[model samples]
Target: MRPAAAGTTRLLCLAGVVTAVGLLPWLSGRNPALTVLRARSAEQEPTREALDAVRRDLGLGAGPLHLLGDWAGGLLRGDLGTSWVSHTEVGPSVAAGLQVSLGLMGAALAVALLPAAALVAPVLVRGRGSAGAGAAMLAAVPEFLLATVALLVCGVWLGWLPTSGWQGPEHLVLPAVALGVPAGGLLGRLVADALPAVLDERWVELWRGAGVSRARVAWAALRRVVPPLVPQFGMAAVGLTGGAVAVETVFAVPGIGRTALGAAKSQDLPLLQGSVLALLLLGLVAGVAAAFTRRALLGPALRDASLTLPTARPVRTHPAIPLTLFTLLAVTIGWGLLRDPYAVHTTARLAAPSWAHPLGTDGLGRDVLARLGHGAASTVGTATAVCLLSLLVALALGFLPGVAAGAADIANALPPVIVGILVAAAAGPGTGGAALAVALISWPPLAAHAAALVQEVRSSGFLTAQRALGAPRSWILTRHVLPSVAAPVARHALLRLPGIALALASLGFLGLGAQPPAPEWGLLLDESRAYVERAPWAALAPAVALALLAGLAVSGAAYAQGRAAYDQGRRTVASAVRKEAPVGI
Candidate 1:
């Protein structure tokens, strides 16, 4: 874990990720030439001669290894090759998309930071308890829903801002806010959770007693709290890019995410690969920036010592708020399930809410309420399966941290939506494919948690004593290590359930998940999009449900996190008390 080794590992991981994308054409279960031909000329007949010509032109029959080598070689020469569909060079297209994405991401980061900064002083002065609920509420709202609502209100109803396109700064406002607010909520929560621990450090009291200003003390504490969160911030940036698929599609912003989605849909491997590389490089840049920021914040101590920087720990928080939200969600789902989701009423299409159709009707006259209820099983059920499967995989990989951990490290950086694109290309789009795509990348966080906890448990004094007593390693591992790691990691996985659902929904919205006639939340939103401006309720029902679910999950997780932190605090205080106590006593 030296900095150099870590950096080297990351570079290798990035290479692995890019290499995987290069293999998409081979893995896609389709003929590259035919697929490209169809993408390029849908009206043309797929004769033998035309297929052979495409194969020769694209060197499709050369085998994957040779193709990959050529692509890599061209990459080194600053060539991104040509798009199969557009027949244009991929470089300029990717560059144009990247420019838009980078600007959007930068604006999002600023939006995230400003609100998070505003909360730090309040967290230092007040306790961390109240902030967690609010932060969870804010963070739980998905970008797609936010974009939809923003478009409806700002663009359609009020005409306050341009909703679609990358025309001007004015066009950026809605998308930026949609992407930024959730991130801000997360960042704010982390600072809030970490600040109380910093405030308890002896230096805070010393600084205050020395007549230091409150603002200065808060600033110092914030600086300490933030460095540990650099990784999370970097992940947030990656998440923003992943989320842009839906957000960009909703607003018609021509970002890399949108381009990648289009390429995936058309089976345009070269363009898809190039777009993914751009995103991967953006993630790399974010990581580098974070490392530099951390180094700057920690200064000499960061280099001089092997500091085990404190990360934000889960603490015990009040469960009432989350429990209430969960209840409301359950009730909504139950009510919707009682109605029939598929009963089409031509005259009632886009109808407003009424006694008969409680949540109103969609463009097809399907009951909005019923769709939400039925879609719950599809969306939430898949998400639950994904979470459980992911936890199992994480436990397995987490316990074996050699090559597996390194692979997990690589997989961690691949965005869920990008993974969805790859999965859709290989397996073809469906609910199963979407779940598989999400599960593919969801395990890394839990695995890392388990791996670190395993290391910590194995090194504990009690474990050392057990070893000296001639206990078998297997016995110790099963009795001590497994239990210790499993519970906390399971809780961590539960906390991530909502996020898994959101990822699945994003995929569905992009046509990579559930198809039409399925009441999946993402599909419902997708189905409602055409009429969203006219019949906002069609979209709002599912959007509202998703928001509620996110709020419940985040709030519940925050409570568990807060509770853990509280326990840790108590333990620290007791440890200190024991050290100061008289030996005889």
Candidate 2:
């Protein structure tokens, strides 16, 4: 297809996806007014007539198709529908939210780039070791935790910045820093990846040999890096749409994220649907535009990743450790689901660990074991769901021909915290929200990985054989490409477990995970913080769970990297063995 035609088709597809996304409230039985009125009806044993009246009054009778038609019809007339909360035209609110969100994203990106550039510069000289590792670690920290710590240390302790609300420049500082720190860390790695190639250029060597200052060399290297970096950042910028929810909410930024969040909470269907659709389109367009802009600036060089940089070494981690962690996670989840956390044990109130009360009790005289058990189910379950869901989405994208790279770029750039928050806002606080959020944000990296694997496999000798033999593309792909890529994708998923775990925890910690009484570890931490002095185990129990989850995640990532190195060496030796084998055995 022609480029413009293809672009138009893709836009149409994305519009359809957006419309489908807007219909989720119906798909999941999450209609806000329906949920609320249902609860009231249950309390009063409401009549069928009264229930129907309530549904009609709250505008809950419309199906997803009808809602979409209404939304599109309103758009044709330049109306953004109306807000249920204030009964005002949503265009004004959406516009205001857009301004805030855009400003926040811009500031956050600006703050992130400076630090990332600094971090990347050192790696160009040092090679990939300390600088790269440190940056990667920092990037792994969830934005919600980053924001919380910043608030505690900077706002409460130091009185440096406002903890909440978009009042002025000062208000934006903390949120930007919270969001930017991880982004900068991510960008730094990309810069590190891109830098070595620039430094390897003949011109760079000649400049250095001619005694051109290190500053000049660095500047030249940076200029080369920027083109590749711009496209990557474009993807990241779009990913920020879902991920910005926590940043906006934590800081009360009054941005589109926060507005949409409220709309989701209240089940203000028209407002929520319109606002989310607009923001999503905006992010997607900006990212695609920025990436293409680089193509315009640097031509084919910026477009072809292989020409710009080498394949990234696959990250490795301890395969056995993740299994162990997964087992423990499973146990906790199973136990939690079977037990009641809120059942008070009057005699064992605030009791220390014993045969009956293994983990100990809390300040409220509740059984600590029950609560911990409950939390384990939610926390681990949420993490597992996030991990698997992300992989599935990635797999789907990778199955597509050319879309994987762009999709992956955007996904990688997104913060899981932002995604978790957005999902929580739309789906409400539960497994569905956290899992969907993590899954959405996690797709980019996996998609990118899958795309690369597909590209590599497409050129393999076996595939060439199949093609030459006139085997169908589907048969070749099913029998060849899928098998070759499966192991690596599985390993990548293991490598990503820690990130998924952290995101789940971060969301729960911010009261955006499983709601009250659901034993979510992050929620436990939040709930037990007040009782830390009285019953340390209540807090310590959840803290330890989180730490273990994090450790397991880290181990998996590190192990994946080590395994990649090991496998590469083994392949080299095997290749040598085959080369030296007698003809036809």
Candidate 3:
């Protein structure tokens, strides 16, 4: 057999084995009733005998092989058995939750994408630096923070929208906007960056020189750019799935997130596992769709590009800004460490800021300031790690075939709560466990982005030219393609960091994150719920910290995108000028 075929077979076997191993515990945790029902009548003697007979009759009594066969058959038929926690049919409950989640997600995408497209159009047309900066600022804000602010302003203060519950369209607006804003900002930057390249293409210039109107050129450029965005749009849709948990919880929506959160807290293994599996399946479907769409849009060119290396862009050294930003970030970190956030000691009814208890105490007698500080650190750290890990996994998987890449995307598209549940079940709940869970959930989008970047870079003239040269494939890929794609990929990765962090913190807040005594921000919020009326600051402090951390991480990503655009702009102008030179004698 060919080496490639052998590799493919090996990978398939590995995937099957890993999946089976991962699901073993969940299967073992199913209801005893279902296990007994599938057994032989002859073994039914006394109650204990009947139980043993049932186990034997079904594959469970026979051996590992029988159990595996039964499990595989059940999985193939989508008979996930009953949810151990909810005591309902796993499939139906998941289906119901999925409907609500998808509805909210669809609305969010509409709100986010349309406005982003409109906002980015002018930037793409003018190639303005300010436009990029604006996009960055918008993208930098975290969704949960945005949701909280929206709740206060639109729901509480103005009463323009409902603060909680999925009553109707009005309730969705606040949460959807909160979710869409960050996504819109990121998408705006992407569209803006992509447009300039298409606008400055040789064909565009050639058409322009032939007396085509600026409008025509712009329209044509947009047409070309639109097709490449299908995969991106699908990827965005998938990523949004992970955010649904926070959005649903914040809005008090009756969705899968709330269900999963409740299940996790109760240690309802079957319900949690079923929810996770459903989420994974949803993400996989989206990813597969995206992969097919990418292929359809790019045609045979993408396959050719995949096999080739990318080329390097000229790197311009920018001085001092990175250092200055780093310094500012450090100061913020220091401030978080030193400052007291919570006010009013509900536990003691003591006055604020005495020498004995500088930051006072919470209703539970916990050190408010210390908890807040630690919570901030933990929240930021966990989120950042999850986002980074997810990105790395996604990038690794993205280089595979379209089908495999799509599978990664599908995994990314699964709901964050579901992912959280799976991770918690698979690894158990803790810092390490949460991070791993986040990574597993976040991998699909990162993979999609990496794949898209690879496609974009592969088609560039520099890469093609490099290939035509006598350069070895490995040397060219390392020296050229990797460098060219690194900055943009890094920017994409950074942009995702805040969102993941917010989601993790939200999960924690809902009591699905770090177990007690971990000092996580989410746990702090949950702890503060009883005393919210007496000491709102107890909850408010951690909430605000979560928002700010998300904002800063997002800002960093936006800044990176802006710098990348500026650099790309300069290269395009230089290339245009070179092409316009007169012929030598």
True lDDT of residue 270, candidate 1:
88
Per-candidate local distance difference test = 0.82, 0.69, 0.62
Candidate 3 error regions (>4 Å): 1-71, 124-131, 209-215, 295-368, 378-417, 439-506, 525-536, 557-585
- Whose TM-score is higher: candidate 2's or candidate 3's? 2
Better candidate by lDDT, 1 or 3: 1
Best by lDDT: 1
**TM-score winner:** 1
Give the poorly placed runs of model 1, Cα more than 4 Å off: 1-12, 31-35, 124-130, 307-317, 401-405, 460-471, 563-585
**Residue-by-residue lDDT tens digits, candidate 2, 263-354:** 76666666776677667667668776886777776776546653354445444444776688778866765665566688876776678777
Worst 10 residues of 1 by lDDT: 307-316
Ranking by TM-score: 1, 2, 3
- Superposing all C-alpha atoms, what RMSD in Å does each candidate have to the true structure? 3.3, 5.3, 8.0
lDDT digits (tens) for residues 1-585 of candidate 1: 444554566568767667777777767776777888887788999999999999788777778898788888999999999988779999999999999988987788788887776656577777444355667678778888888888888889999999788878999988888888888887787778777767777898899899999878878877777787777777777778777777888899899989988888888888988998887777667767777877777788675545443565464457888889888888888998898988999999899999988889998788999999989877888899999998898888776666455666567667788888888877778999999999988988888888888889988999999999999999998999999999999989988988888889888989999988899998898888898878888888888888888777777877877777788889999999999999998
Clashes of 2: 17
The better candidate by TM-score, 1 or 2, is 1
- In model 1, the clashing pairs are 314-561, 314-565, 315-561, 315-562, 315-563, 315-564, 315-565, 316-562, 316-563, 316-564
| Candidates sorted on lDDT, descending | 1, 2, 3
